[model samples]
Target: MNNQHKPLQNGLHVVVVGAGIGGLACAIACRRANPPLPVTVVERAPEILTIGAGIHIPPNACRVVSSLGLLDKLKQAGGYQVKGFTLRRYQNGNVLVEKPMGMRMKTEYGAEWLAIHRGDYQGVLLEAAREAGADILTNAEVIGIAEGIGESFGKHMVVLKDGKSLVADVVVGADGLWSGVRELVLGRSFPPVETGDLAYRGTFTREHLKSFKNERIDQLMEAENVQVWLGPGRHAVFYPLRNKTEYNLVLLVGDDLPEGVRTSQGSLEEMAANFEGWDPILNTIISCLKSALKWKLLHFKELDQWTKGVIALLGDASHPTLPYQGQGAAMAVEDGAILALLLSRLQNQGISDVPDQRNQQLSDLLLLYQDLRKRRTEVNVAGAVDTRHYYHLSDGDEQICRDKELASLPDSAWQGPCSFNWGDAEYQKSLLGFDGLADAERTFDEWSRKKSRQANI
Candidate 1:
């Protein structure tokens, strides 16, 4: 298995479990490869439906979306181009930091920042995957995975709850946070850890906001920007969607929810109580919320490995993170893109006649995928954790220092003692301007050369 050799089309079949953002992106990326690989995505739900409320797709992810030719579709689906973010004081609604994102993002990162409804984003990816020749099987709940099975020498078996099974050359566990495939890969369950925080999320249309009859609320409904208010043990984020026709809001608060109770019907009174004494604008937004669902915020522990034999995990299955930095979906999108690049490279290295060699080649490729993705994903996970602390700081000298640093504005290029930097453009670029596909290709080349030298020695 070398870069110089091209793998013959031995009819490799890839089965991806789960049809969320990560799973759908993986299927699309694989099928769109130069010499496209056969892909089938199995989703447990009776029908594909969006579970979350909204998602912020920063430039890092926007680049991938553009490369896949779905940016236009995303925009057409009511994706709002975010101008920038405004961080305001919780008590007074005074601006602390104004980080411009629209033109600045494109000029520096080569892609626009987009705020979109989660369902619309998923629909775009699903449509693209199907158009790229990937088969999608709905209501096909994968109950378990069995490796080293099948008469045609299949490497893995995906057992379904419906008593049907699918055998494939590779099994992708994109099933998300409570992934059964991940448990199978690790030989035990490692549930995500609770972060002592819960979020109430909802979306509101412009017409709905107009009912409030408040001028400030009306302005927010018309503006194309993301707004954040930080308070002790709490924070709120709201942004427009679908050409400013709608707005999405997320309210995070310290909670005492019992273990294993993740989702419940959230009460407006409870949500408002958490923001007591806060700016009136946030209250208005809260008033406009027609409905909301509250869920505990949980994070996954870094895994020792993301792949076992011929099975691999992606997205939330591998590294589920808090939404503090808004990079959870971005990381998953990058994972799928890079994984596809590596697999496509493997396809170019013609298959071996010996079964052992073929298996070893596939294993090596999986290892490379893990090696390329592990460090970045871990950094993002840690960054999100750091953001959680910074965003929830109580009133004190530390909070004062954070506000001072933020007050320095877009002109100051300095890093303070705070855990997160809200105004630094360079820091933002490091996270937002990353090119995952390019990085993967570069790393693969380096890895191949190193192995080549070792073989000669």
Candidate 2:
């Protein structure tokens, strides 16, 4: 066993389970912190496979990615800069709301919204993490985690499926919704609940779409915009990718797929059946979709604690939510950025004279990370649930009200007495303009001063 009393800059090791987006981002951030900490990321998959479809990189998330010097690489990997989003009625494809996303979002939030393939995004983060000095080990699945001995020794043992054990000063669980580390931290199993939502995702090249010979489809293919068709109990979002060479489409509906099954082969006929009476343009897109993967959406109840001792959780492992708001990955990225900031602050404090003080400092740092992230993530999780309900409102007075609010877009131009505004100024400010690293630093500064004053007393 490694000596527990070694200084953080010298011997502190961060073992991150799961080499997904959150885990890779955490590894990169930790290694890039001042004094440069050692980080090792383990993945259960034998090899890194390009999993999932497209992802929306909102302005808030883009800022973090850019800070990591990955914006150019991300773009090179066929990431499309989202210019705007058009919300339309699922019945006839009538535009209800149009919101600008490119220069407008950049001018307002200091970052541009990007839409990219999930594989490209993860690859960028993974590569950047590797370059930042994080050791990545694939096919190393963790089975159990046990607390280290002594209060002053902030160490934990991570046991892998291969019967190998690794000890680290801290352990981070970013293993997605079905996180084994979460079960260990909580001392019981906490399975994710099916949200009764299923999504059919697919990506097709422009050449394949051109064979359809539909003018509406051709026009849609040419347009550089993220389009969403909303209706009762369902919605579909489509966007272009790879400099308009390919497009990604996602359809979400209420379903009763078996629990624990992430995805299955879905036929185009079944996908079309879900939106039987929707717009003809939608039908055109659906018909062109070759083979789609339908996955059951799952949600985790807001965890009461994301950290216990030196072990902590990040991303879906800590707070998994519906995709209604399109902030799941963004929230996970924010968690990684904030966690890095907190851990860096501890490194800045230098090794304490007393071993007990050093241990307390490490514990306090993890607590601060939880404090800075938990409330924001909880609120966002609830917001995702609320958005899901709002987007799928049945044809009623509430739906009518929602349509009116959506119609009043360009929020600045609307002078009517609408109680709700889609993408309103307040919402934009809170969601787009949030700087997680800055927020974490401010909170940590306040906390450190408070602790110093208490110590003097």
Candidate 3:
């Protein structure tokens, strides 16, 4: 694992579209995880703006970040480490479920759940990628993709808005929900389908919290913890951030696309309207909010194939999960890290020993990466969908059942395997070894070898 001396394809070039969280993380992970490879990131947007209100970085994702050597940088970026998650009744402040989060996760899983401003988090990854020898080009829209035209591997002729063309050995479509690269590969006009839920996301200052008299509300805004209020068909999370100076508010409501939510316009008035039935404290908090944006939560129906030829999708481009599980960005980060690892290894294996035979190795490696990703992301997607209904439990019996299930969990279950031991090198090794990928490839390889033997016979 001495990255500097590790062999890599001498001049392998990789072009990544979209410099969002996943793209940037992919670049950094590829550079730092394995041997260094030439990586270029093309972002269609001129400047990276903080569009997301807030995102939860679970312990597993945090482990990957720590493994990538981003803990200190994240801390410096004003990311808040969460202590625990408290589930409470929607109207009254009665604790329903309390799960230890930060230090507990670290002790059990060897990582902490970190919550950070999206902009700062993206900046941290982008800066790291740039410093790690990645050529980051902003305002470069990829309008066309030319696959395997001249080279055996393939070339992505990225036509920028300025009519400039760039080529690379591989093109990664981390472009996100409305990915142009996905369209080029999938061969369909697929769009992000709306989930009939609207998200009112905002960041509130301490001054704005004066209207909330609930002690639990005060605790949520001031303490280093995550609090979620669950109701019928709706839920809201209030958590402290920016060193407790500000509170991040996320109100998930089942409503049509409100006019105020779409353009990122409108005052706190529109935000309050969505919470009519919610507690007065919530309405008061929304009324005092200085800024807010409404996001139409769109969940993509699963695609049969995430890749074809040289172009492949990443993050939301591959699998878009609803926000219920709070693992959207986390899953994206994991995807980036694992893909980088596989490609880097393939690049190394090809350069020193098999230069002339590199294409097959690279192709096989990409397929392996896809195989490694598919089912795990599918599981998360299913869990996210399922949790949406679970959290928004409308039926009284259903809510009672869920409560019973939660309560029935033995204390030993809670204490069992809270987090992963990321410090162990063996644990890292396991992540690289796609369990199902290996099994499937093994089974297929055995069949192929058997068929060849029979032919010889």
Query: What lDDT is reached at residue 48 by model 2?
Result: 87
- Once fitted onto the true fold, the runs of candidate 2 whose alpha carbons sit more than 4 angstroms away are 1-11, 147-154, 259-261, 353-356, 411-421
Model 1 earns a TM-score of: 0.94
Pairs of residues clashing in candidate 2: none
lDDT of each: 0.82, 0.82, 0.70
Give the number of the best model, judged by TM-score. Answer: 1
Where in model 1 is the C-alpha error above 4 Å?
A: 1-10, 148-150, 413-419
TM-score of 3: 0.84
- Per-residue error at 404 for model 1, in Å? 1.3
If candidate 2 were superposed on the true structure by all CA atoms, what would the RMSD be? 2.8
Steric collisions counted per model: 8, 0, 3
For candidate 1, the 10 contiguous residues with the lowest summed lDDT are: 1-10
- Candidate 2 lDDT score at position 146: 67
**What's the residue-level lDDT of 171 in candidate 1?**
83
Model 1 clash pairs are 6-348, 6-349, 6-350, 7-348, 7-349, 7-350, 7-351, 78-242
TM-score of each: 0.94, 0.93, 0.84
Better of 2 and 3 by TM-score: 2
lDDT of 3: 0.70
